[model samples]
Target: MRKFVLAAASSALLLSVSTQPVKADDDLLRLAISLCDFAKTDDRSSMRRKLKAAGMRLRAIYPAIKCGADGSLLRVATVNNAFEAAKFLASKAGDEAINAPEEDGKTLIQWTEGLVAAGDASKQQFVELYKSKM
Candidate 1:
């Protein structure tokens, strides 16, 4: 009888644990998206908070750093839909261009230098954040 009860309790615990949502990383990614969206819309305070919550790091000088780059990988940017995907990712991921692997063995910074030169405000905010550590 005791053995049966122990097995039942273990099963219940396992079932409960399995049913819990497993999306810590997903949540962070979502938050990163939100931060980028907010930045595109000129919502700085909220965007900053969202980026902070996601544990993102900014290594670039500003969103303009990559704003003009081909943004094909991010469908939102491909459409020129007002969403700065690179800026958002950089703010949260800490200079994806710095280490983002690619076919030409190029960093995100090198690939997006043209865009960065265009003076992206959203990316500039990230640089500020990186500097402030906020």
Candidate 2:
């Protein structure tokens, strides 16, 4: 009976340990999706608050967050016309995030130009911000 109990405990411990990474990944995705929501809603303050609470820097995690189809948080804000969020995200961007190509293989500036040509000229300021970083 003692051996059986030990074996059962060991198996349970191993199973829990093996599932830990998946839980962390899920938490990461959940946080990213919440940030995406804040951007889409133009809620820069809430985004800032959450980032502060999590001790995550936007410049550091910008490329990793996966905000939307565009992948960049700034782009997601821009597409949604969340100007405050777009500007806030843009200002926090490091050069790598600013220059990183979207899924379509175009840099943010190049992508924004297409958006502007298609009549999203309002996002010109974001393009300018990216250019300043470059």
Candidate 3:
């Protein structure tokens, strides 16, 4: 009975350890959802508060948090025409994010150029923000 108890305890410990990452992923997902909503609504204050409360920077969590169909937070801001949120996100962007190709397999600059070429110059402010970060 004692050995069985020990085995059970060990199994419980292992199970808890294994689930840690899942919990972290869940938390990140929730954060991403909230961030996406804020970006979509152009609520820069809420976005700032959320990240501040979580003690995280946009750049640090950028790679881990996919902003729904828009892909990255920057893109979400872009699509929603949330210049304030876009500027905030860009200001906090990391080199990897600035340099990394977006979900459509093109660098941010390329994507912006394409959009401008298509007569969508609305994201020009975001481009300027990210350019400074770069």
Candidate 4:
């Protein structure tokens, strides 16, 4: 009975440890997506700190992840005008991702343009950044 209990406890510990990384990755992704909304309420310094931390975690998980059709984190950041977060993501994503198209075939440049049309003059920096990469 003692050996059985010990074996079961060991199995449970191993299972918990194995599952921890997946949960942490999911949390990082959630935090990355929420960064856009967080930027709205937080000061730039606070936002930058959060963005940097999230970026570090995401980089560890996905060292080569780019702004592909599925990288909704970049899309959300750009759409919400989370410039600092977007920039941090861009740094990790590389130059090719700067113009990568979404599922609808729209690039980050197009998204920034939409913001510009809506009177968001601040997005010009993003536009220029995308263009420079292209």
Candidate 5:
């Protein structure tokens, strides 16, 4: 019947639309994390511009930190030694970000401490940032 055909067509259109992945923001977030490791070769200004154009909040939490667990953007930035990205998120999210804990109840400061113990003393700046906020 004509009605049945129309209904099926509409359903297929809706399914396709819904299944399309909106990946701009996700790509930006991943790039932001990667920038931390390649800071010398990366352009922080360009990254920020792209993220802003996509309407992605610098402080938005990405849920990929711990296998579906939620974590602030700051957490990811700090974990990867992305100083600029972490500082930007710290300024935006403030105390909430400074004090955010992982699923294991470990705070950002604690994570930084662990990094320091492991010979990454540069993360000390992050620990100081969170401590100042506290």
Candidate 6:
């Protein structure tokens, strides 16, 4: 009977721990998405606030914002371009991508190819920035 009670108590503790929501990271992900938008719209103030809220230090949103204003894939791509995408990735996985590709199998540089092709200077700048960082 004592063993049964101990087992139940242990199971309850494990369940509580497992059920805890990862709220902070979730906020970071949401902020990443918002930052991508601000990058396109050149809303530097809003971007700063969002990054601050998410506890992420601003890294590369400037170039991405430039690209956004210059009409890059920021306006077209469902996901943010390579720059913003890479920024989010770096935030979640540390700053060393080391040639890591996105889930869609494209390197960050390759992912921004479309933006470059469209003559979006911001996207180009982002690609250059990513090259330097990588």
How does each model score on lDDT? 0.39, 0.72, 0.70, 0.54, 0.54, 0.45
Per-residue lDDT tens digits for candidate 5, residues 61-92, read 33222212224455556666667766655665
Model 6, 46-131: lDDT tens per residue? 76577677554554332222222223223322234434544443443333342545445666567666668877666776666556
Please give the ranking of all candidate structures by lDDT, highest first, separated by commas: 2, 3, 4, 5, 6, 1
Model 3: per-residue Cα lDDT at residue 44: 92
Ranking by TM-score: 3, 2, 5, 4, 6, 1
Candidate 3 lDDT tens digits, 18-85? 65855654555567678888888889999999989866677666765566456777777787888888
How well does each candidate superpose onto the true structure, as a TM-score? 0.34, 0.75, 0.76, 0.50, 0.53, 0.41
Model 4, 1-134: lDDT tens digits are 10101124323433475668556545444544444344333334554576577444433332233233334455556656767766665665665555667556777688778888899888788787667655
Clashes of 1: 9
- Higher-scoring candidate on TM-score, 2 or 3: 3
lDDT score at residue 14, model 6, on the 0-100 scale:
34
Worst 10 residues of 6 by lDDT: 1-10
Candidate 2 clash pair list: none
How would you encode candidate 2's per-residue C-alpha lDDT over 33-68 as one tens digit per residue?
778888888999999998898666777666666654
Q: If both were scored by TM-score, which would come out higher, candidate 1 or candidate 6?
A: 6
Predicted structure 6, TM vs. truth: 0.41
Global Cα RMSD, each model: 14.1, 11.2, 10.6, 11.3, 11.4, 13.1
Better of 1 and 2 by TM-score: 2
Which regions of candidate 6 deviate over 4 angstroms?
1-33, 56-94, 114-122
Using TM-score as the measure, which candidate wins? 3
Q: Candidate 2, residue 2: CA error in Å?
A: 48
The residue-by-residue lDDT of candidate 1 on 30-75, one tens digit each, is 5534544454454546655764664444432122122223322222
